[model samples]
Target: MGEAIIFKLHLVLGTTIFLLFPFTRLVHIFSGVAAPVKYILRRGYQIVRKRT
Candidate 1:
């Protein structure tokens, strides 16, 4: 195996993932995973910002 072959494999996998992002359960999975992190961070920010 060579570096060129590894790069091609990575490029192909990345392309496939990009293509699948909007048309499959991949969308749900990504957003489902990110939403709570945003919610949790925002909740903590509000609690800390208003301490007076």
Candidate 2:
């Protein structure tokens, strides 16, 4: 039936989007947070070395 075909198409589109998400900027918004974490880690290391 037409409804079944529409359902299958929706599933395919949703799956395709899910598979592509990691390569999209929508994912970058999450990964971008790591930059500050890296900076904080490096800053802490520097502080620890400077104190010793």
lDDT of 1: 0.68
Q: For model 1, how does the per-residue alpha-carbon lDDT over 1-52 read when each residue is reduced to its tens digit?
A: 4578889999999999898778863354456667756655653334456667
TM-score of each: 0.44, 0.47
| Candidate maximizing TM-score | 2
lDDT of candidate 2 over 1-52, digit per residue (tens)? 2568889999999999999998864553555667656644553334344554
TM-score between candidate 1 and the true structure:
0.44
Model 2 CA deviation exceeding 4 Å by range: 1-3, 31-52
| Residue pairs with backbone overlap in model 2 | none
